[model samples]
Target: MSGFNTSGVLSVAPARMLVPILLILMWYLGRLHSQYEPIVTSKVSSRLEEARKMIPSVKLDWPIPLAKDPRAAFNSSKLALLIEARPLPHLPPLILHMMAVIPPDWRFLFIGSNESIIGVSRAYSIKHQQVIGKLDLVELPPPWSIASKEDVFRLLTDSRFYDEFLTDVEWILKYEHDSILCANSETSVDDGLGWDWTGAARMGDGHFSGYGGLSLRRVSVIKRVLSFQARFNDSEPEDEWFGKRLWVLPGAKVASRFDDAIAVEDVYMERPMGYHIREGGGSLDKSVWGDAARRKEIFEYCPELSMIMDMKLERQRCPDDDGNGDREMADVQVTTAVLGEGDDAKALPNDAESAVLPPQPPPLPQPWKVSVTTFGSPLRTGID
Candidate 1:
C-alpha cells in the first residue's frame, strides 16, 4: 500500500502545475490587449482636454486638428445685422433708424416676407461718391402660412442665400421683426466673437435659448448647423430646430449677455440693448416712444451715432442716380462674382436673387476673396 501511494503522489504534480500555468496564460492575454492602454489613454485624454480648452462649447468626440480659423475669412467683414422686417408701414423708418447706429462699413442683411414693403436705399457722403451706409434685402416665403418663426431656416440652410449674400458676412445679429435697439445698448460690445474666454458663468440656458430673439451669431457656427438640418422637422418651431441642432454642435457658440449678445433678463443690469415690440405689450406705438428724449434714450447708446438719426432726418440719403436714369433704374440689375467657396458659386441658381450684377459689381462691392490654408499646421493664434 505504501508503494502504490508513492507512485500516485507523482501524478498530483501535473495538476498543481496546470493551475499556475492557466493563471499565467490569462494574465498574459489581458496584458496584450491593454498593455498600451496607459500610454495611449493618456495621450488621447490630453488631446481631448486641449480641444475642450480651445472650444469650451459642447465637448467634441475627438480632437479637431488645428487649422486656420474659418472665421479669419471674415477678416474685417464682421458683425452683420439681420433684421426681420414685419410688414409695418414704419418698417423703413425702423430699418433706417437701426442702420443709423450701425457703422456704414459693417454688413447689414434685412430679411423680410415675400410681399414685404422694404425699399432699397443707400447712404453716401455728399463730399465723396463713396457709399457710407448700405443694406441688402432678401425676401423668402414664410415657412408657415402666416408665422414668421421658420424664415430664419430658409436663410440658414439655403446655399443660394449664402452664396449671393452671406458668404463673407459673419456674426449675424438677428432681431425679430418687432424688436428694436434701445437707447443705451452698446454697439462697441459686438467685436463679432461668439465665445467667452473669460469663463464667466451664465445663469440660464446659455445659447440653447435661441439667442433670446436678439442675438449675434458667428457665421462659422451656423454653417456647421446647416449640416444637421435633415435631423429636424422643418414644420417645428424654428427656435426648437435651432436649439436641438445647436445643442449638439461641437464647437458652435453665440456671444452671451456679458459680451452684449444681450442681457434683458439681467436684473442687475438696468436695461437691455434692445426691446421686442410685441403686439400685445411692447407694440411699436409712436405715442409711447415718440419724444426725442425717449427715443434718445434708445439711440444714444452709441456715441458715433449720437446725431446720426438727426442727420438722416435733416436730409434724405440719395445714392447717385443710375446711368440708366430713375425710371429705368427700377430694372437696373446689379451682379457680383461669387468668391471663396466654389460650392457657393455652383449653388447659386439662375434666379435674380443669386445672380452677379449684369456687367458690373454693385455700387459698393465687397469682393470677399478668402484664401484657405490647407497644407501646413497653422500657428496657434489664440481664439479671439
Candidate 2:
C-alpha cells in the first residue's frame, strides 16, 4: 500500500509541474502575438490613411473647349501656368514671383504631391483672382499603398509622382486652358546657366527641338496627345517629353527673347521678368541622362547658353511697368554673339560666381493680377 501511494504521488507531482509549464509557454506566446499584431495593424492602417489623403477630390466642369476656339468660355489670348510642386518649402513665394512676371490675363494651374501645399495654392488663387485661374490641385497617391514593397520603394524614390502629375497636366489642358506653359519654379540661372535664346531661336525655326524654363502652347495639342490614354513611364522625364511634343506642334511660338546685356542669367534679369528655382534637389540633366557617366558627358558637351540668356532676359524685363514688351532688339544681338563667339560660353561663371546675380527688383508695389474664365457644363457623371 505504501509503495502504491508513493508512485501515485510522484506521477501526480510531474503532471502538476507539466501543466503549469505548458500554461506559461502558452501565455508567453499569446502575449508576444498580441503585442506584435497591434504594431503591424497600426503601421498598415497609417499607410492606408496616408494613401487616402493623397488622392485629391477632383471636380471637373466639362464641355470646356479642348481647342483654341473664339466661342469658348476661355480665350486663347490667355496664358496657362502649369507648375509641378512637391512639398517644397519655397513654393508659395515662387508662385508669387511668377504672378509678377506674366500678364494679368494668364491663369495658374498647380500640380504636385502634398494636399497642404495645394490648399495654400488655392487660397492664393482666390486672393489673387486677377493672376490665378481655376486652381486644379492633383495629389499623387502615397508610395506605400501598393501591394509590393518594391513598387512602393521605387515610387518613393522615382519620378512616378512627376509622371502622374504630367497626366493631370494633360487633362487640365484638354478641359481648361487653350494651351500650357510648363515652367520650373525651382531653377535659378546665371550667365553660365541661363537661356540659350539662339538655340531657342534655331529650335524655334526648326533645327533642334526642346522646351524648358518656360514653354507656351495651346490646349488642342494636349487633347490630341492624351486622347489615346497613353501613360508616360516613370523612367521618362516630363520636360523632355514636353519639349519633344512642343517642337512638333504647328503654330507653337515662344513669347520671350534672350539678350546678353539683359544678363538673362540673372533671376532679376529684366528679360525673363520672372525666374524659376529648380526645387526638389535632383539634377534635370541627371534625371534625363539615365546614366551618371552619360549625364556628365552631356553636361560637359553642352554650352550653358540657356542659363545665361535666362538671366539676361530677367534683368531686362524686371523693370518694366507692365509685363508686356520687355524685349529689346539687343536680345538677338546678344544671342548671336554668344552662339557665334563660343568665347561667351567659356566666360560663363561657376555657381559661386553666379550666386552674385543681382537681387530681385523691388517687389512690384502691387500684387500681379491673374484672371481665369471657367467654361463648359459641369461634369456630374462617372469621372476618375
Best by lDDT: 1
lDDT of 2 at 181: 17
lDDT of 2 by residue, 195-221 (tens): 222112212323322223433333345
List where candidate 2 sits over 4 angstroms from the true fold: 1-79, 82-85, 118-209, 226-232, 245-270, 273-384
Model 1, residue 123: displacement in angstroms? 11
Cα deviation of 7 in candidate 1 (Å)? 99
Candidate 1 at 377: error in angstroms?
Answer: 99
Across 318-341, the per-residue lDDT of candidate 1 in tens digits comes to: 343332122123333444556557
Which 10-residue span in candidate 1 carries the lowest summed lDDT?
A: 123-132
What overall lDDT, based on C-alpha atoms, would model 1 receive against the true structure?
0.48
lDDT of each: 0.48, 0.38
Please give the TM-score that candidate 1 achieves against the real structure.
0.42
